[model samples]
Target: MEEFEFITQSADETSILAKRLSEKLTRRDVVTLEGDLGAGKTTFTKALAAGLGIKRNVNSPTFTIIKEYTDGRLPLYHMDVYRLEDADEDLGFDEYFHGEGVSVIEWAHLIEDQLPNERLDIKINYINDSTRKIIITPYGSHYVDLCKELRDESISH
Candidate 1:
């Protein structure tokens, strides 16, 4: 239930923060993103992919629901559940959640019941044009430590 807040003045800043976070991620890590439209969820994911050493373009899997990139330091599973009106459907989510990779879910609230008990939840809010407030809530010890490291890195930067 620990929370960390970070303010970004621009998309570039947001990306930098996301990339920093990605460096702390590991296999089976789940990162859930919540925000309104144009809040830069996809932008953050792209930067996270870059940090993981993924060379491919990372975009929202709005229609596909899930996209997998395995050519990185660790596999990246990008999921956008916004289009899933029926969250009851079993899409083998556990396979991804427990897979040897990091899973980044967009609109995770839609599949709240399916999500693991331990995960990192991130809420992005638009403060104004070109500014965003990122609130990170860590639900497990690993995530808590990860946030602490991220905060320490941010401070030393």
Candidate 2:
């Protein structure tokens, strides 16, 4: 398990960071978002959608549970499992995880048993009205490389 930390002073900064990350994403990638309400999970997803070239609006899927955006460079599977209490619900996660797009799961901890072995886990901590501390953990080599690349780029700048 490898980790990287980033502190954003504002929501715009968080969006910029997420855009930088989205540029590195590829097909079949799974990214989990864990945080409290209003911690910027959907905000990050919106930024990611922009980076993926998705023109549609990205909103919290609290009621829909899952939303698919296909206009991007690759498909974007955005899921909000906040309402789920068990992993027994058959939401057909396999198609999304192994599909031609990337999956972004919010409140992922609730479905821990269903997640793939290799993926990226991100936790957002609210610091103030506009600040947030994001902790990113890579569960496999692919995500590790992604973090390394981001870290190097941040250091170079």
Candidate 3:
């Protein structure tokens, strides 16, 4: 469970990072995005969708709780758990976890307990108006390989 730091110079960079991460995605994967307001969670998710071959518009599912986008190669279960007030809100969390798609949750800190044990944790920290410090932590072998590939590219470039 080691963490790797990725610095993003712009929103586009964050999006590119998301796209690259999504390139290696398959079914039953959980990606938990953590950040403050305007930290680019939605931006990253949109990039992920684009990478997954989704042609639909991607937005913050804040009001809807869960947004499903199947236009992509695989199901993209975009979830925003910010609306949950109940600490024990299990509301359809299993649908993404136990389902056939990959789930990416925004404001996942709200429903930390509902997440799977082996997943990817992506955190975005705004360093300024246009800069972000992104950290990726892998909880299993899949993500560990992701981090390794990311690290290799980082080292090469």
* TM-score, every prediction: 0.98, 0.97, 0.95
What TM-score, to 2 decimals, does candidate 1 have? Answer: 0.98
Question: Which of candidates 2 and 3 is the stronger one according to lDDT?
Answer: 2
For 89-157, candidate 2 gives per-residue lDDT tens digits of 878987899999999999998888889999999999999999999999999899999999988876776
lDDT (C-alpha, whole model) for all candidates: 0.96, 0.93, 0.89
Indicate the worst ten consecutive residues by lDDT in candidate 1.
1-10
Q: Report the number of the highest-lDDT candidate.
A: 1
lDDT of 1 by residue, 21-130 (tens): 99899999999999999999999999999999999988899999999999999999999999997999999899999999999999999999999999999999999989
Per-residue CA lDDT of candidate 3, range 3-105, in tens?
Answer: 9999989998888888888888889999999999999999999999999999999999988889999988899999988888894956878878878888999
Q: Where does candidate 2 stray beyond 4 Å?
A: none
Comparison by TM-score, 1 against 2, better one: 1
Off by over 4 Å in 1: none
Compared to the true structure, candidate 2 yields what TM-score? 0.97
